[model samples]
Target: MGFRDRWVDWGNGSGFYNLRVDDVSIQVFRNGFALIILPRYENIESSDLLSHVFRDLYKAISYLYNIGIVVDLDSIKQVNQEYAFNHGYLDDVLRGRPKKARVELDRDARGLFNKLDQKAKAWIDRSYGDLEIETNDLEYARRLLLMPEIIYNLDKKLAPILEELSNQIRLHLEVEERTLSTLEKLSRYIEELRDLQRRPSLFKRILNWFRRWFG
Candidate 1:
């Protein structure tokens, strides 16, 4: 019902802000990017689930960004500075590796390490284990809420099928939430993501125009 954020240490000289709801996680990165994490479920059809989640996330971001959660130029500078310094200081990741297995950082990515100020770097890197470092720094949670990939952990299956009886009208789906007790409860438009492949319906296109003026 509400949204909140916390700092997450990404290691190797990077980290980001994290906000979550049940199984869905929203992340804002230091580099001005966002991601929404959703678990692949066995109950709700995936295409239907993606569409519903996309809309909900879009609305939530619009509402939240309009209210206050913002990342300005100054914040971007600070986060980058911190990440650059930390990455440079965390020499272990770049050193002591077999020549064949060394990390292959791109030119621009590797340059971040050269711009570091050792004195400003966090020696302890509290993000490794300390839980209390800026635990209340929600404002520093940074920006971003959507983009890129949807990583599905196949090993993290929702639930095993206990029964598969034929001719059954009802199916027990172990998906998004407990409230979705049956398959019928999923959204009526089950092909939201797939629908993008063709073209949007006339009603939907017109409906969007009306929303812009009315709401």
Candidate 2:
């Protein structure tokens, strides 16, 4: 069965949703991904630069996943490390798992966790991850993601240039655009997943109160 099939109240607007990217199951509020109106709502072509970016991003994030999140030191201007995932893939991993990702000389430091010997080669139990977007980043992601037309329009406008560049400069501009888009979409997707859970509207809150009081 699909992951959403396990949702408790998927039919209601107030239920939670479970999205399984892999072994990790991200639980979100009802309709959490409903706002993720991505542009070009079609399968990304293998030749598309964005496909490469997405695949690399996923691989980087998943490499040390069993150990925990690999925090990007340069991704945010603020350096505060936040909680992300957990590591319990071994009987002793829980005892020594790093609280968060370690930083590298520059960009993503997820590589730091690659050499951890604490993890067993075999599968084990784990429950150390949380589905969250910083409270401060919600609007940043929501607003940019809501404008799917902009991305589509830009892609259309650049069709000629992209075609020319593919033969000449070899997707330099396209690669930049694809890379940025990949990061933006991932951030927004995470924020969307945490939306209703963090910022329930007044009406929803009241409804929840009623459910509790009446039940």
Q: Choose the strongest candidate by lDDT.
A: 2
Candidate 2: stretches off by over 4 Å: 1-129, 137-139, 147-150, 167-215
Q: Write the per-residue lDDT of candidate 2 for residues 1-215, one digit (tens) a residue.
A: 23457565736456765444433334444432211111221234424634644554464345435434343534412211122222234335446644433222222312112322222121222333432222122223233445587788888999989788776766677788899999999999888757755766854886788899996
- The lowest-lDDT stretch of 10 consecutive residues in candidate 2 is 32-41
Q: Mind giving the per-residue lDDT tens digits that candidate 1 earns over 16-109?
A: 7777655566676768676655443333542364576556555546544764665342332212222201233434554653322222222222
Q: Which lDDT values do the candidates have, in the order given?
A: 0.41, 0.43
Give per-model TM-scores.
0.25, 0.18
Quote the lDDT for 149 in model 1.
22
TM-score of 2: 0.18
Q: Pick out the ten consecutive residues of candidate 1 with the lowest summed lDDT.
A: 136-145
